[model samples]
Target: MIPVTRRIAIDERELSETFVRASGPGGQNVNKVSTAVELRFDVAGSPNLPEEVRQRLARLAGRRLTLDGVLVLRADRFRTQERNREDALERLLGLIREAAVPPPPPRKATKPTRSSQIKRVDEKKRRGNVKGLRRGRIDHD
Candidate 1:
C-alpha cells in the first residue's frame, strides 16, 4: 500500500510497471539491459482516490494521462533497473500527494470603486491635455 496522505492510501495492486531499454550514457550495457521503468496507475478507476482528487489528478496529469484514464510515468534517469523503478514509484507518490491537496478558493468578483474610476478618467484627461498643448496652433488668416 502506498500512503498518499493521512486519509488516502493506494493499494499496491493498482500499480503496473514495465521495463524497456534506455538510451544514452550506459554504452554496451544500455543495449543489453532494460533500465527504463514505465509506471502506470488507473487514476479514473482507483477506489482509493476521492472524486475531487481524481478530477484534479486528471487535470494535473495533462499529456501524461492516456485516453483510457491511466496515468503513465516514465523513469529513465538512472542506469540501473532498481533505481529507475524507485524513481518511478517516488514520482507517482509525489503526484498523488499533490492531488490530495485541496484547491484554492475561487477569486471573488470585484468592480472598480467610483472614486478610482473617476481618478483613472482624470488621469487620462490630464494626459490628453498635455498632448494637446504639444501641438502648435495654426493661424487661419
Candidate 2:
C-alpha cells in the first residue's frame, strides 16, 4: 500500500509496471538491458481515491492520462530498472498527494472605491489637458 496522506492509501496492486530499453548513458548495456520503467495507474477506476481527488488527478495528469483514464508515468532518468521503478512510483505518489489537497475558495467580486474611481478620472483628465496644451492657439480674424 502507498500512503498518500493520513486518510488516503493506494493499494500496490493498482499499479502496473513494464520494463523497456532506455535511450541514454548505459552505452553497450543500454542495447542489451531494459532499464526504463513505465508505470500505469487507473485513476478513474481506483477505489482508494475520493471523488474530488479523482477529478483533480485527472486534470493534473493532462497529457499523461490516456483515453482510458489511466495515468502513465515514464521513468528513464536512472540507468537501472529498480531506480527507475522507484522514481516512477514516487512520481505517481506525488501526483496523488497533490490531488488530495483541497482547492482554494473562489475570490469574491469587488467594486472600485469611489475615491479610486475619482482619482482615475482625474488622472485621465490631467493627461488629456497636458496633451491639449501642446496644440498651438488659433488667431481670431
TM-score against native, each model? 0.76, 0.77
Prediction-by-prediction clash tally: 0, 0
- Candidate 2 structure, TM-score to reference: 0.77
- Residues 39-112 of candidate 2: C-alpha lDDT, one tens digit per residue: 99999999999999999999999999999999999999998899999999999999999999999999999999
User: Candidate 1 residues 82-119, lDDT tens each?
Assistant: 99999999998888889889989999999999999999
Clashing pairs in 1: none
lDDT of 1 at 74: 95
Error of 2 at 70 (Å): 0.6
Best by TM-score: 2
Candidate lDDT (C-alpha), each: 0.91, 0.92
Cα displacement (angstroms), candidate 1, residue 114, comes to 12
Worst 10 residues of 1 by lDDT: 132-141
In candidate 1, clashing pairs total 0
